[model samples]
Target: MTSSLFYHVSGDGQPLVWLHGWGVNGSIFLPTVTQLSQYRSYCVDLPGFGDSQPQPGTIDDWAELLIAQLPANAIWLGWSLGGLVATRIAQRWPQKIRGLITIASSPCFMAQTTPPWPGIAATVLQQFTQQLEQDLQRTVERFMALQAMGSNSARDDIRHIKELVLSKPLPNATALAQGLEMLQQTDLRQELPHIALPWLRFWGKLDGLVPRRVSTLLPQTPQSQDIILPGASHAPFISHPEDFLHHLRDWLQTTNKGV
Candidate 1:
């Protein structure tokens, strides 16, 4: 069962929901929404992030909880960990998602036991988990820096991320731990082919977290497409909103035209 999640709704048009990456909340997308003003946007603070209360469960559990509160049908856009949740929704309840967009995300976030996967090293994730117990704030800040590591405007990018994180209530300790566990254990590679929705994946060529190599390995559906922003890092939308929006608007327009 899922608890009521906190969200900010705005604009008026086709329903478009925004899901932020791990460690940050909905506010991080505030700067970019103006560019998407043509659509009715719902920026969500996933279960335990931002002001939402924490709920313990697996990725599917999080998806089920979120699906219950979403519009019957909407364009679902997710980033990083939120992307995993959004993909889960696309898989479990395809009827609810008109389209799926994933930013700086991978079907599998960690290396598999058999086939090699492009993702954050297991040791790096483990360090984050261990550090969280010692200094939650510092650990989160470190994660924020990692997201902007390869961007040309890395300092500004980190500032924006930190500002957004500080703008809301800090994520719950349990939620942080749970999110790390999800990143470390969740592997959706085999499940990717099962998703039938029109999917668009956006990546940062310089992203250290979700490497570009992962995109090559993702399951290719007939409607799947990907774009990588040069000189951008994990948070391409944050670092280069205009460039990100350009491609996004073009894709949406083209997709709409086809319909």
Candidate 2:
């Protein structure tokens, strides 16, 4: 179990766990995590990503493994597909998390015109899945570019993301495809209310992948707040680090006071 997953811990104070998005590893959070000196950050490389071993199982199976590896009773921060896992943990083991923060994540990640869900189109994800088989590096790089799409600093953002991604081991091909599938399949709308802990949602006004419109569509939960960055994209923390941290730190300070 010790080697099943990998987590890097830094900073010192309250514990804050960070989970990265699909196609990228936990190391993607380093830029943002390093600036936050208020809390101990446990950045975890989900199975098959970064330094972690690839494990085959549903998200439910993985959550049990995740909480066991990190400090219980810490605030959970997840981005993109990682947010789905964080929400699942909060739903099943509420006591393990004191607060929830999801960045550019949607409860349901597939577009639905009938229900009017705002998410990435199914066809786009399918293309990534198929492309991954042909060219792993190009597929991941494309996805990274998409995250920074529409941001004013998109060029810089994509370069930064690609640099971070290459610093660590590339994700397993299976894991990348599985992650896309998860994004297409997982839905946490009904379970949002169960996360009674303090929750904050971060969105980018220009994000193509988890559109800012999603903020309005999520089910309202008590003690929840949403903030959208005007010049940011899917990876706001990278595209607008200063702005992202401003809102993130301010919310953490206020939540610490109340929680």
Candidate 3:
């Protein structure tokens, strides 16, 4: 397997690959994945974050690298930026990726009114991109705060996410910059309707970023449905992990029955 990025495999059952949000590593899912004993989890650090040290590249570059390291027919689950990457992987290699799960993510992240879209304002991300060049810590801290904002346990969520970010090697400015660029320019809504594989869209009712409204606006796929978790924010798994797991297991069971 490729050793370019850091990854861990645990438990034993159907394979599950987890990709984390920007600014943090895959270990952020440890608390919840550890409880998903039914899945043979493969949690990996995306390039430029955690122990993974490689030049930051485009979304296609990311998908090719990650898919090469995992088994075929495995389920892919991504959060925020990671979700975008996973979606690309499923599109690029539909045979390898059997199912898709996205949390707090949107195909078109840049908000626009021309096509009637819901997403992040261009100015806010523009500011973050500018600030990333100056102070990586402050910029990431601010982004983290934005993520935890609007959650019922907003204060506690920020503190916990901070601890996770601090525990690993921070992603370089270039990585953060490139990630923001992807968030600003990428749009996959036009492609969602074409994918034939199963997809589950997870959302937070209180999310400040990637508003729950985006799911409704997404092009509906044949095997896709959106599950909005009440009282959860940007990080639904972090806010209510057990509830998250409950839904996941139930869905997996339902999916397997058809197989």
Candidate 4:
């Protein structure tokens, strides 16, 4: 109900909903959305990011909010935090999701009792949260830079992300704080089995945030597909736009007749 959850719907054909990573909004996928203009695309702002304001509920509730807005049985694509949200949507409402595409996202972003194959150490998240609490603005700047670690264009990517992040500005301190908490506490390993929709997982080899090895942690399903992008960072759509779009188009064509 909050206008803070802003979205830009473009293109024509079946909806391609994009969810962005933490600390950023749907704009992170702007390159993809622009290139894939032939397909109906909806880039959404997670609660607290972009124009979306903080809401009272868990991350599952945030998924529900997106589901509520989506056209019936729309195609869903999420990156990092967005991927986690998409997974939750599939679990909660399998019938409404036509397919799932996760970009540089995994079932578990942080290690748990079961231990995700390759995920950020719990200590890293804890330190980030601590620093963020201590200095939200500075922490966000550092996080933007961290997204492109180990990349040739790391500096440019960081600058671009910083510009994008600052353009909209964070909604409120409460939402930002709560969203960070959600990111740290969320673990969807147990819920992955409940997803019955066709699913696709993507990873960026150079992504320091969600390491490529995280791809191995995904639960094997009958209708699941996985792709790994070489020489790509956390934001592959930006780093490898052509390859990313090509693969995306091919997957859409093969899967649902580009429905």
lDDT of 2 by residue, 39-91 (tens): 99999999899999887767776788798888988999999888888888888
- List, in order, the clash count of every candidate structure: 0, 0, 0, 3
TM-score of each: 0.97, 0.96, 0.96, 0.92
Question: Candidate 2 overall Cα lDDT vs. reference?
Answer: 0.87
Candidate of highest TM-score: 1
List, residue by residue over 130-154, the lDDT tens digit for candidate 1. 9999999899889999999989999
Put down candidate 3 lDDT per residue, 1-259, tens digits, no spaces.
4438788788888999999888888878888888988889988888888888665568887788888877888899999999999998888899887799999988888899997898898999999888888889888888888888888888998898888767888886777887888898888877877778888889999998888999888767668878999999999888878888889888888876766
After superposing candidate 3, which stretches have Cα over 4 Å from the reference? 1-3
Candidate 3: TM-score? 0.96
Q: lDDT by residue for model 4 over 150-248, one digit each (tens)? A: 766777878877776677876466766666666777878777877877788878888888888766666778778888888888887777778888888
RMSD of each: 1.2, 1.3, 1.6, 2.0
| Candidate 1: pairs in clash | none
In model 4, which runs have C-alpha deviations exceeding 4 angstroms?
A: 1-4, 113-116
lDDT of 4: 0.78
Error of 4 at 118 (Å): 2.3
Q: Would you list the C-alpha lDDT of every candidate in the order shown? A: 0.88, 0.87, 0.85, 0.78
Q: Which ten-residue region of model 4 has the weakest summed lDDT? A: 110-119
* Better model by TM-score: candidate 2 vs candidate 4: 2
Once all C-alphas are superposed, what RMSD does model 1 give against the true structure?
Answer: 1.2
Preferred candidate (TM-score higher): 3 or 4? 3
